[model samples]
Target: MSNAKSYIQTVALRDVKCYAFHGYYPEEQLTGIYFLVDVEVTFVHTGDTENLNHTVNYEVLNTILLEEMANSQKMLETVVRRILDRVLDTYSFLQTGKVGIRKLSPAMPGEVGHSFVELSYVAPK
Candidate 1:
């Protein structure tokens, strides 16, 4: 059988609000920082909305973002990767996912408005 999917559904959590600590510097870990996390989960829409069983829950996505941020992974890349991996693993229907995390105001001396990182994952068929 071909590995092509018939229908694809994209669920996105854009700039989901969060104020958690995640950084490498001592001050960054101590003081903590606010961040904006954006996540996109794509899956095969099997037209099973009536069941809601085969679908991914929106709350799960939000929880992953909040829980991961609270862990202080020491880098945005880690957070992004974790979120993507977790989402992909949690949902068998999920095909691909992307996570984007941006620090609202970096602690650096220079005027950096936001420091951001984006990561993506695709599950094997």
Candidate 2:
């Protein structure tokens, strides 16, 4: 067997559906929209992986997303940035991460699947 100094692990919360009134257009604000949020974070692994403290909790991520989404904004970029900031702030052990928000059936002329924005985080050296 080979000895290793440390391991890196990534935890993700995917396809989280949320309904919020976030849009630049007035009509979109009135009608509201469905969004799918995906969050993932990479961190240095600890020996006590079984312990909740040693790893990122999915519930915490969900809570952050919901809380941020509750506050309506004209742009998804703002929401995504807020989510990423919260995640990084919540866990000091986090190394890198990404937060993505997708607006389903966006209010546009042509048939569009979704409009998406993603923000990433990297811990300072």
The alpha-carbon deviation from the true structure for residue 47 of candidate 1, after best TM-score superposition, in angstroms, is 1.2
What TM-scores do the predictions have?
A: 0.87, 0.94
lDDT comparing candidate 1 with the true structure: 0.84
TM-score of structure candidate 2 = 0.94
Candidate 2: RMSD to truth: 1.7
lDDT accuracy of residue 100 in candidate 1: 95
Residue 94 lDDT (model 2) = 90
Residue pairs in candidate 2 whose N, alpha carbon or C atoms collide under 3 angstroms: none
lDDT of 1 by residue, 41-63 (tens): 88878877776577778888888
Q: Candidate 2 regions off by >4 Å? A: none
Candidate 1, position 33, lDDT: 79
- Alpha-carbon error at 87 in model 1, in Å? 1.0
lDDT of all predictions:
0.84, 0.92
